[model samples]
Target: MGIKSFQGKRDTSQTNKAEEQILVSDYMTTKLITFKAEDSLDDVIALLIKHHISGGPVVNDKNELIGIISETDCIKHISESKYYNMPSDINNTVGNNMVTDVDTIDKNMNIFDAAFKFLASRRRRFPVVDEHGVLLGQLSQKDVLKAALKVKGNTW
Candidate 1:
């Protein structure tokens, strides 16, 4: 009877830990890739492909989070414009297509909270910021999975 009670307590403790241990800070990818507003479309595409990332935070010269750019955003622009290999002003085309608004999260936010936001919006990524909304890094479903897999002794 004593052993049974001890086992029950252990199980409860494990459940609580699982529920409480995960936070955004724990799962967020602190090392982030970023883009500038003036960056060319080719530049952004190269960075994304080089890192094999789907998206990243966009920052101003002061490193403040401004927006987010993703493959989806790029495609949206391409489909909307539907003008490839046409003689056009590069600056105007790129400028009009950039995504200028995005959702963000705090580093101290719980991972579950971030997960809920991601699921609700169908957005796979978000920028992680500080108290003043300074860009810290990016958090993605991949980052969360990396953390979770680590916890289970599964290397990412």
Candidate 2:
């Protein structure tokens, strides 16, 4: 006689459910602090401090992303002004100091892939954009950590 099998068949449905992709949009922060290119650095600094944020996206009048401004950039501008003996608070604009070559992530991108991108780029946050490159939201390293924790039992 053939050997009897006591264990039931494995549940493939559960396996499939565990593999569901988690997109960046689900975890990204929709409420963002944005700046304009013409915005004064002094004002930007004040807002950054008031909101306790390290940086923010710079946009145009049409609300399109043009660049990114960070505390590092502000410090750089201050240092340069000091070296030149110029007034740091005068004529400094976000457009002049913001990083134009900004790297963005797709809203539909998988969370794991976004995490990999964060690791590769060494960026604390990534701006999530749409097909037209409109500013939608921002995915931060903390968001990725939260995702990991949520899916730990299923995916990890």
Candidate 3:
């Protein structure tokens, strides 16, 4: 007689269900605090504090992302001003200090790939955009964490 197997057949449907891809848009924060290039750095700082956010996207009149402004950037500007013994210039614009070379994520990208990008780039957040490069939302490290938690053992 042939040897009998003890384990039952695996559930292929369950495996497929667990492997269903999660997209960045599913967890990105659409309601973002955006700034204009002409916006005053002081105002940006105040808003960052008010919203308890470390950074935000800089957009144009059409709401297309131009750059990113962060607390670190503001701090650097402030430090330079103090180092040079120059008084804070209220006229300093976000455009002057914001990071222009931004790495953006595709809204339809897989969440796992986004997590890898975050790890490789060491970026706290990435602006999610469409084929037109229109700013759709932002995906932060925390958002990735939330996605991981949601999937948990199902996909991990």
Top model number, TM-score: 3
- Tell me the tens digit of each residue's lDDT in model 2 across 25-50: 99999999999988889899999999
Q: Estimate each model's TM-score.
A: 0.74, 0.91, 0.92
TM-score of 2: 0.91
| Model 3 segments more than 4 A misplaced | 82-85, 88-91
Backbone clash count, each prediction separately: 2, 0, 0
lDDT tens per residue, model 1, 6-52: 44443465565565556687777777887777777667777888999
Candidate 1 Cα misplacement greater than 4 A, ranges: 1-20, 80-84, 90-95, 150-156
Global lDDT of model 3: 0.90
- Poorest stretch of ten by lDDT in candidate 1: 86-95
Q: List the residue pairs that clash in candidate 2.
A: none
Candidate 2: where are CA atoms >4 Å away? 1-7, 88-91
In TM-score terms, candidate 1 sits at 0.74
lDDT of residue 52 for candidate 2: 99
